[model samples]
Target: MNVEKKRVLKIFYLIATSSEELSSCELAKRIGVTERTIKSDIKQVRDFALDNGAVIKSRRGSGYWIEVFDSDKIQAIVEQLVIHFAYDSSLSDLSSEKRSNDILRKIIAQDGYVKLDDIAYELYLSRSSIKNEIKEARKVLESFNLGFETKPGFGSRIKGSEFDKRLCMLMLFEIYYHKAVLMFNHTQLMNYFECEDDVRNDIRHSFLKVLRESSCHIMDDYTQRIARYLILLRNRYKAKYYISFNPEKKVLLKSFKQYKIACDIIDELKKYGGYDVDENEILALEVFLLIWADIDSTSDLAGDYGEVYFEALTQLEKISERIRQEYSIEFFNCEWDKKIFLTGLIPIILKIKLNCEKNDMKSSVLFNDSVRLSPLSIKLSYSAIELLNEQYNTKNSFASHLIIAYRIYIIISKVKYDYSPIRMIICSMHGIEVARSIKNSIINKYSEKYFAKLDLYELYEMRALKYDDYDAVALNYPYFSYKYDWTFVLIELIPTDNQLQELYNKVILQGYQLKQFLEFFNFNKNFVFRDFNFESMESFINLISFKHGKESKFIHNIEYELNECVIKSIYNKTCILFINHQYVDHNIFEIYQLNEIKNINGEEISHIIVLSVDFNHSIKAFKFIEQLSHQLVIDRETIYLLTESEKLDNIIDIVRKGLNSEMISLV
Candidate 1:
């Protein structure tokens, strides 16, 4: 089995070993993935289980649990499969992340300095390759306050405070626990602490007993984390690696309830291991105890008391006020909702305060889909969060922002739809020469009488255009009028008196509908054009960079992503709509109108739209592009309008209102 397969197996193993069914949300959180991905992963796991003579039982409201018959045989098969694949030299072929993790685990599990050559040999890689892996792994370790030290003879080793060292171990364990447990086994894990099996077992018992005796509650996840820390702390204590708490930490320690708890744990250690724990070690334990308490309080935010709770509430109040001012949506409408939400923010605030590391897993696929599916919620939540950050000096993670977005999404879904202004897009093959006047004349005629906004676009014979953004797509020529599910109208650039009245009746008076106000004529009786000219694509990319990537810190990231799309289009020689959302936080899209200039060889090329938005707001944009690309093969008039039209602002405006349609009940 590959590592991914092994991971799925481990998830199944956890579910099988659990006493109760696990929710998809909780499972995704534990596995550091989005719930949407988890659902698909679960289905794959279910299929695998069926072939393996096992069952994954799921209930409608509850969740999934595993069922296995003949546990011994299943265990034997799993263990054998895991060991075989995990130890194979093919492990070197794993992704850079997996390879780096392998090297890090090897470095930390060793008793002394780990030679690069030894790692290369173990993982089947070159010495220089292992060095690069170590370099990458160092980045991850640094987040936990751990660093690497290199000597002349011995290669390199991790050097950090004993506390940080244990924390790094736990963090790594979460990502590669199954692989490490299977490959290194329990004995090596004990060897990392320079202890025998009996000593390790005694330390575990004493640590838990102390926690139980002191009535200090530890969550199951944190219990595993603390247990590992205790083992390392014992070895470090024996080796005389004690913590030297500064005056500031000591001052903070004085008021901590966990201090007494730490003292009790130290007494238990002395009883079991027959070692007199020093004052410095006791203080170190207290620090760990305090951290444990922080973790515990965060587990159930509503139940937490004291400074953390009050501080979060204050921040929430400022955030709420800023949101109301910017979006005109009242967030603090009910005291009950406010309290529940404020409690939720506690964990997010704690994470920022601690500078906790997040999993490298990208935002779940569901997150992207949800943002598109709930435009109103996304718009309000994204705008509000931006304002909150500026006003309250709070830096929330993307995931935290997503939580707020989801909450507002639910609330907004429950309310009645607000009246929205109708947006219409007009396209003409005569280009901007006629599009502007037609749009202005129509808007002037109808603006006072109806709630509608009209914009004009030029029609392209070779380019696909997305008409979904507009309530109606008005076309000038018959062949130019593409068939789409959206409301479309065939009218002349200069409408006749009867045609103008018919347009007013159909669009302004009749709300929204498909209407051919004027008769369609085949005006292109004799026309043949093979030449297609376009302005330099780079100019538009630069324009977008100037518009969206002015922030110096993000310029490189933005350019790097843009270059990938540019390269992709150039190599394929295809008209592309590039939407890069890797680093942005708001919606931004740009169109590069292709000009019909000729080269020395008189060859012509096409143009593209470099529409970039935040990752959350990209689903609808991507769908639009996908459909547009298909339409390009069947109809080219849309691209003509896009390149030749002067209504760039109108096109952008319609796209800005892309996902903001009112919710319609199927019933």
Candidate 2:
């Protein structure tokens, strides 16, 4: 039967077995089909039931149910359908995913060319269906570095390295057979492989014994997979199809301790199964062992495995550093978390380095869904894959990035700090008690919902206070003077509801300001250039100018402002150069660490801070830029931190801290 007919049969079976009426929505959801498709299929089901001594009844409010006039005939129909749909639900044509998988399995299982007509007949599909599935199967084959070859009359075959072919076969076997259950019964194995039960049992027993003797901690699923691989290998070797390894790689594999384990398993195979295997087969087994064997810690990876262990550690550290430099987030803070990540990461790194990475569509879809939820994690994962590709000289796949990003998102979700807080100052002229009362009331009201740090100050001490240290000021007296429009909330001596709400609104505004500041800068690593050189001031100005073809005049205005208002000073070990310009359409900020000291206006300078702001930009954003300029000239510690920080994220954090202070003054 075709897939749609089979689906209709399955639907009829569901309706017959259901205790309650099944709605079109429920049936569609259960069958993974649309409600419209379900409605049409129900009509087909009704017609088929009428022909087979059964009736499908439906109501306007309720859904579908089945009534049988001839139980024997209905039972016989269900029995025949069960043979096709019981073990694998994919036998029903729902989507191309399973069909494509089946195509891959059929091609990989055959020794030589397999005809399209033969596959179509076996799958109960049309020739067109098989052709469409072939395209998907080809994509999967290409990912495994295998080729799909077809002839006019001879049919199609998979072509690739023997090692890759075996890997592809193992992966497909995992998808098709072992997906439902980790363990397979002796009868199932014998029937599937067409081998004697004793041969399958011997292979399983030998693999388990070798793994146990080597103190390898592998999951049950992987153990079953290894057994399946060995069974397939034995069959392939019997067919005179053997694997060949590179001479250099074979030598390297022989030196590893896993090689001995591989040898032990092969010897058991030869003794019990009467199999003939060679050194190349042993090397392939060693590679499998290397990829699958789980090590709890670096100490567990003794002997030749130590090289892979160390390389995994180095690559992990590089990824961690990249995340930190770009996002200002700590990646590996806890040693336990590091160990957990290392254990999971080692296998993947081994897979990539050894060219055995499995591209499972289900796993890729799941990880991609999870990574999409976190925008920052998505960016970090992309950056991480780029770093790995550069270091290894290999093009990693999207699935690889998704996997890494999912792991990174998990770790970061736990360690990332809540950096948003509204700093507020509470003052009163009525006395300290009134000030304390108002502060306590505000804290008791908003502490749970909003993060606000409240401090008490006398009204007389306002002039002595550093305005930059607080975001909002609450005072009983209304008379206050400041250059920038500060968030001021005038509270009553006893604090009325209206006064408290005003204070809360000011806190909300401060939060908005903080958010805008962060969004404006964004703090991309690309903004910071290290060891950059420019010969003259004109060249540097032109390099920083925005490229607008028709707005050359505006660009010239920005360049003129930058040259006119540039500030140069020698601070500690570096010459700090600060350049600020206004009247631009958008904000631009960059930091440059010169390769050597340059003479700009006869002043030696090594570092440059460029800030360009739009005249129409938000006051809060402009204040932030102004505050940063003020810090660069007067704050010696800020200068030291900006110049001496190794990671761009550290510099970003420093600047972010300055911006968060919300201090506004004349520049």
Candidate 3:
């Protein structure tokens, strides 16, 4: 039977096992699907069960129930169905979402094209429904930069670099398995991946043994997750889908200690488990270990990233400095904050450069919502974005920016709100009357928002006790050290507003802010030339003019106009020179890169920005540049990150979304 028949059989079995009649609505809720879908499923279930020794009886008022004449035959048929749906079903069977995920796995697992007709037949869906599934599969494949190619006779296959294909397959495993859609326990998963029962048990034992032999501190749960990753890796290779890592890239990963251990583990799997694993798969496993192990700043990312690791570090350092300068908050002081920011930021930077996925509009909503909750973080985050947009060649998607913002929010939440008001347990020796009086006075004097909650506890019960559950202790009686760092407030029989104010000051810490307004500047890539020499800077303008077949004097005219605008470094590090030319044939706004140059007035000089406007497109360019300049002053990091790796189209798309100007034409 195909998946749809198996589903209908499972539903029928459920109703048969039930003592009472079941309504379609109740079954739909249990199955996590629509009532209409359940009704359709019931028709198939009734037809399939009738010849198989069970009759589904329905009355006018009552719902549906099952009656069996030959229990032996029905039990035999049900056993057959269980064998068919093994490892993919639960107490309940697959829902529509789970079915879709299964279809995706099937498509990826196949080494060659899988026919749409075969898929439809197996899933018990019409051609149209299967077509819709294809669209979803394409969306997922496109996000990984894999091609969902189809031919008239050849059907379809996901095409991509082997490295990316492996990454996508592993990510799919993580998403579906974590959600319990695959519904396979460790041993079952191994069996599904084609491991023999003995081999499966040995692999499990060997994986744990390897972890023990090495002093790795991964928990059992994480060890299991890694084992699942290995299953997928071995399964893919066994099916002839292999990943080949570049020899140059492989050399770079040798610096990581985990890489060596991963290699040893693979060797053991090959020796004992009767599996053939490739060198590239071993390298990929190392990447998975680093991410899943949750390594902090102590991790040598250079093993996976090569020289770019140091560049990423410099970028993170610059971002931290901006946050500290703008918010007056320190991050490095808190080890948790430092670890989180670094671990999250490095992978994100690599993903952006690789253009691994498309940005969903929903992630932008999350970014905005997070910023709304914290107002001060916005200025610093925006500043970071602007700097990144201006400096990097890479294009950052809104989703990418949102992830960066989330990491920043994690750090800022610790820095900004760590001293928020505490919950209190009020204790008094004078009985409930005195405690009530103090509590009422405090509540009426200050809003309940200032404190989490106030509870009354008797003084006698406070002996030899530590109130660790509450944030602070409030009492009128004398007390000794309880070994907690919480605020302890004592009030008189009647407390004054002045005493309340002092206590409030101690409870609520002061926030940080910039003493002066910081200004920013925006430079287009055409204008940005890193380590530029004077002759080369002038040569680039002439080359552009010559390429457009314009007059040589027009180039000289641009040089003359450059004097009108001040050329200075906006970040106090790199100088940018920009010129807006009048009435050119093309509306050109290009950023040019230059190799580093020294001995220009005994100081390093780089970046030449050109933002030229044609007579007709002048208004649009002017409006866009105006908005760009504003973004530069407030948030340079946005510009820097956007420009650093590459994403001009995305940056322009962001600008187009933000600006509703009729005069500004992005196309």
Relative to the true structure, candidate 3 has a C-alpha RMSD (angstroms) of 19.2
Per-residue lDDT tens digits of candidate 2, residues 150-176?
888999998988878777776666553
Would you give me the overall lDDT of model 3? 0.55
Clashes of each: 14, 0, 53
| Cα-based RMSD of candidate 1 | 18.1
Q: Each candidate: RMSD to true structure?
A: 18.1, 16.6, 19.2
Give me the runs in candidate 3 sitting further than 4 Å from their true place.
Answer: 2-60, 65-103, 177-192, 196-198, 201-205, 208-223, 297-308, 318-340, 349-410, 413-667
Candidate 1 least-lDDT 10 residues: 514-523
Scored against the true structure, residue 244 in model 1 reaches a CA lDDT of: 68
Which of candidates 2 and 3 is the stronger one according to lDDT? 2
lDDT per residue as tens, model 1, 392-444: 46544455555566566544433332224566777777787676777766666
Candidate 2 stretches greater than 4 Å from native:
1-93, 176-192, 195-202, 268-271, 274-276, 298-304, 330-345, 361-379, 390-393, 397-667
TM-score of each: 0.45, 0.49, 0.48
In model 1, the runs with Cα more than 4 Å from the true position are 1-92, 109-112, 178-190, 193-219, 258-314, 317-338, 341-667
Model 2 Cα shift for residue 169 (angstroms):
2.3
Candidate 1 vs 2: which has more lDDT: 2
